[model samples]
Target: MKEYPIMFTAEMVRAILDGRKTQTRRCGDRWAKVRPGDRMWVKETWCWCWKCARLNDPEWYHSHDEDDPSIQLDKCGVKYAADSNNAFETCDPMNPKTRKEEFKWQPSIFMPRWASRITLEVVGNRSERVHDISREDCIAEGCPSQDWYRVNGGPEKWFMVLWCNINGKKPGRSWADNPLVHAIEFKRVKP
Candidate 1:
């Protein structure tokens, strides 16, 4: 099976972790090449412990070598934002901090393959107009059920709002525009 890295937002990561999300839809056929049995490693916000210890200095890597023996592998490992609220590191041998601190969470796009903690196996793929998404598909996309949207509208309305929020500003991608989308159905295969 082919392997690919798929980026996910913190919210989407949470949804997948919580067993609420099993599918994703792109504005176009960007994921068209993905087929059943393909593996997707989720890319989420994360930081290496050594980087976190350096006060999250963005350019810290330029000065230090990751393979340097001085860098403790145990203390300089990868930390995922979805798994913890904070990351702790022993920066000083003399005076170590007792509490954890929030990691300078990197963007999902910047996450490396080694930092990915979740893996998904593609089960299906299809193309359809964005407006054709059903309530079931909405749930698969991590939206609340129709009952949850009863106060405001239907599940479609809720999904429309979410889709617009993510794609409305892009040219020809708004819900009203009804752009064809590539829908990828997957199941979590690894933790």
Candidate 2:
């Protein structure tokens, strides 16, 4: 007789059957949605919503189609909470030695409600700064936000500016700094 390892606890097994685990599935016009009683192949690295597990084909999981907009958004929303080892810490932009090291990190501040229409501007000595400025919009929502990560790269030699609409009528003041690599500038369009 061969012996197999039991990895899932009774509670976890129960949760899976009860549709409590993170997964995604196709529903009507949408590609990913939550559904109950969906069967999922549980693995140490298989992390997803309950719906995704049922709707996602095993072979398609590793393919680029997994990057579908709806799938990405749903996954983004669940990433921090679902990952068992997610953590973050504050860092000093001025001092590198004082920075906290962790596997997962994000900004402590919540994005303003007007964040949907925000724009980013970058002014640097190199072309890379332009790409960096565009990547700033990848900030993940909720805990473990990507704001800090967006601004943490490169040497401590450049300045950055971030502007947004504060009152929905006029452009808010720009936040200028040289914490990372090249100076960046962001300007909000007047509404």
Candidate 3:
């Protein structure tokens, strides 16, 4: 079975750990290879001073204890502790020679499946524009609709900014840009 290493922000990780998130959007090109039966291993970007840490200042980087693999594994395995397997580091990002420090800030592409604690079975998937995502799907993306869009505005409005940010596109990439996104629905599974 094909497997994917899916990255999640810490907030979304918490939501997923809480069993509230069920859907996610990925760039169409990136997700094109994901089949319905594939499995997704969730990787959480550490919560830390990303901006400062990116400058190579160790102080900022270590402030949150993000370097500890066990911590990340623990954070990722919050809900699925029984199924978590840290005995083997995934091969994708780690060869026996890969230093532990190098794994700390490697991009998601380098994250190996074995690093994940949460595994999801892809139940369904569809292609749609960022704006085409429904309010329900937005909630699945971890937005608390009532609080996030308290005004007359709704999830779609809020989703626009979020979509742009995640995609690293500037604003106005909204429905006007009509960026293609793959909406993937999944169920938590025993790893």
On TM-score, the leading prediction is: 1
| Candidate 1 TM-score, true structure as reference | 0.77
Per-residue accuracy of model 3 over 84-176 as CA lDDT, tens digit each? 333223323233333333324344444455445679999898898776788788877767548658784787776666666666554534556
lDDT of 1 by residue, 1-191 (tens): 99988888777888898888999888655589899999999999887654334644547645666546454443545667777743454444333441245344688888766667789999999999988888889888886655677877876777788888878889998887899998999999965
TM for candidate 2 is 0.20
Q: TM-score of every model? A: 0.77, 0.20, 0.61
Consecutive 10-residue window with the lowest summed lDDT within model 2: 23-32
Question: Top model by lDDT, which number?
Answer: 1
How much is the lDDT of residue 174 in candidate 1?
85
Better of 2 and 3 by lDDT: 3
Model 1 RMSD vs true structure: 4.6
Instruction: Output the better candidate (1/3) by TM-score.
Output: 1
Cα-based RMSD of candidate 3: 10.6
Name the candidate, 2 or 3, with the larger TM-score value: 3
